[model samples]
Target: MTEIPKAADADSVTEPASASTLLARYLHRQRETILDGQIAAGAHDDPDAVADMVVAARRARGALAAHRKTARTQPEVHRLIEELRWFGITVGSAHELRTQAAWLLAAADLLRPRYVRGPVRARISGYFADRTRPAWIAGRELLASPRFPAMVEDLMAEERLLRSTVVPGIDDVDNTAVLEALLERVRSRMRAVESARGEDTRDAAMHGLRKAIRRTRYYLESVDDVAPARNAQACQGLAAVQDLLGGHQDAAVAKHHLMQIAREAENAGESTFTYGLLLQREIDRAAQYSAALPSAYWQALRGARVMADVHLGSAAE
Candidate 1:
């Protein structure tokens, strides 16, 4: 059995390494994570395996994003990034629905017995289960697809290539510079959120900001060996921001689903009273997350600055 490495072990680097070397190590770790996930997912219908594979793909993609120049210069590596993106989306869709369903189910559980009227819980459960089934089937089909094996092979090939050879000017790729660029994008996304004119636009901007924050956090994690304490702090702060935004997004999605079910229930002449109550709770939850975004963003900004202050060696632009 190939056990997945611990987080600390994956990021620890005792000796100095080139920028290329650091990235290679990071990719290797991600590959191992994906392989471990595949094993676990096969033996058990583990959602955690899906989550692990998704996170690993995102981290590997983020690392390549951080090293923009290298990714641009290496056509094969660029292709790998695209494939990883597709893999993450395809492999994780079913899991995402299940996650939302689980949270919504718990929220429904919190409703008072008197308010829970007329098969509302059953409807909600059934609705999500119905939606999840097709996605789950598709995901399983994808695993058995040729594309899945191709992605695995690509990852292996890239890792070996990275380890054996450093691309031209890859040594000049500065961790600080890459992180700065990522943080700057986050800042820009925050500004977009602020300047968003309508509800839909604002929602999109907020989602974009959440993605930027997550990418920044993953990039920092890739370079954790350079300055473990600072990187950890930075990643922790960004995670807070990402998670807060994630909560809002989840509530939003849950509300959307709830509304759809409520409409269907109305057509069927069922009481939509419970759905109204549930919607209110999700609304309040989303509002709380929105209100907390500012402080979280500030904390993340501070941590990123501290982490970027370290001299992690740089590749020339």
Candidate 2:
């Protein structure tokens, strides 16, 4: 289980116990904020419910206000403290915390201490803590959840976001880092598949394509925000390639699922020609998908004006 970083990790500065207690309360309060929203919405038109809702609504808002103190307990707010130090990100109030949980997690990973120079680490860490944090968190969650159709849509949207944002920001040094990350993600997922075998191994390998596609989408979208805009059409074209591949993966998985159902039927002595035919259709789909994939996205990505934009004052204009 992922540990929720304690606010104390963000600061050595002494805090009032009252403050910590208040923050704890806030988490419980907002944890079911959606449920409260529904209740509040329903109560608005009920004369008898209005009084009760008013009290509940106030309590909810107050809970949020209290949690808004101290950034480190929640990942997003802690990044604003700009202290990569476990002791530096302690947030003091809701006003101090600006980002969300996903950003905080990503930023924490981004700021993992390294042998690199301190200022460089700080800057790179800042990138994840701020600009790309939400996407990183959400993308990781999406990648981990292997629903094929959703992954396909997410992969495509990620591609578009890159063309519009990520590639527009980066430095020459970081551009190399970007390419390395993209390649590494792809290779890592591919390796996951290569290392496994049997029905399980094949399933894992198929899942690797999902992971690769998502990571590729993230790196492209992320770094694009840091580099000068190139030809957007090129980016869209890359997305098209991923789309073809995604369709293949989806069909393959669906066909496999159908086969499982068919096998169960066969155990009872039923014919499964329909399931077999579905599997064939998926196989055909995969072949077509692989055929449509472009050679460019598959090649190593490099040579952008990485530092020409998105470094705050680093925009090359």
Predicted structure with the largest lDDT when compared to the true one: 1
lDDT of each: 0.79, 0.37
Candidate 1 whole-model C-alpha lDDT, 0 to 1: 0.79
Tens digits of per-residue lDDT, candidate 2, 1-317, equal 11121121122234222323223333333223323432443444222222332233233322222222222253433331222121111111111122222322343344325422223323323433453335333422322343322322332332233223322222112334444444566567656655656644655564565545444443344334333254243345445545655565665655554465456556757555544554565567655664544353343232212221233233233
Best by TM-score: 1
Stretches of model 1 off by over 4 angstroms after superposition:
1-16, 46-48, 312-317
Give a tens-digit lDDT track for model 1, residues 1-317.
23333333333355346666677788878887887777777677655468898899999998777677777887887899999998888878889988988887888898889988888778888888898878867776777677877887887776566656766535655566777788889999999988888756767788999988888888777667677887788889999898899988988888888899999899889999999998888888877887889998998899888877774332323
Provide the lDDT at 92 for model 2: 14
Candidate 1: C-alpha RMSD to true structure equals 3.7
